[model samples]
Target: NQIHSPFWCPTTIETPTKKSEFPVPPCSTPFNHVNSSALSYEAQEVRRCLRQGLIESPEMSHAESLVLAELEDKLRAAVGTRYPQDD
Candidate 1:
């Protein structure tokens, strides 16, 4: 018997922007390093939906709201504590 794990690497290694980069702190979520204002409009809407309790399905919970909140916190920490709504 033989066992194998799948691993991959890209031929091109593009530099990371806060929007598209690997995290400086790996455990953090995506958008954790992006500016709320700098984020794409779609990102902003998703954040809004997450915070507004518009989740459509029972599979999603308020706990997800907490995760979204924490992600926003980490993003704020990275980008100097801004909230898009405050703009």
Candidate 2:
């Protein structure tokens, strides 16, 4: 007969009873609320550009292409993929 102590067992680990909490400081940047119904095309384009990542190739789907086309001309120029052939 063989017996293994709890300290020597690999699966008998004990966890802490209470977890520590992190206190996050409030954001330093002030927030300016804009009306959703008053968003202009250019504002929308800028929002879209900021949210999307750079596409490296033209192998994207038709839906993706449409979304890309919706981006502002300056944004497209920055991405350097104005058209499918540009990839």
Candidate 3:
């Protein structure tokens, strides 16, 4: 009969407990979150407010996104699509 060493068992393996050695650097520039409510048509934020809904075509969806973003900014709320109006 042969006896095995105790070091080879699963209990001997050390699990990593430390955080990433090279952590991702924080964004140097803060996200440019625009105040949609204060914007007018002239201050069109056509890319800031888009939720980017699922569309049949990527191009179509992108165009709709741009339009919706502009509308949301100008109107200060969701301006298109049949949403429940605040009654």
Better of 1 and 2 by TM-score: 1
The estimated TM-scores of all candidates read 0.28, 0.17, 0.21
Which of 1 and 3 is the better model by TM-score? Answer: 1
Give me the candidate number with maximum TM-score.
Answer: 1
lDDT by residue for model 2 over 22-61, one digit each (tens)?
2223444553532222334435555665567633323445
Evaluate model 3: give its TM-score: 0.21
In order, what lDDT does every prediction score? 0.50, 0.45, 0.40
Question: After superposition, which runs of candidate 2 have C-alpha atoms over 4 Å from their true positions?
Answer: 1-39, 54-87
lDDT of 1 by residue, 19-78 (tens): 233222233335543333333444666777778887643445678878988887887779
Best by lDDT: 1
Counted clashes in each candidate structure: 0, 0, 0
Q: The CA-based lDDT of model 2 is what?
A: 0.45
Score residue 6 of candidate 1 by CA lDDT.
Answer: 17
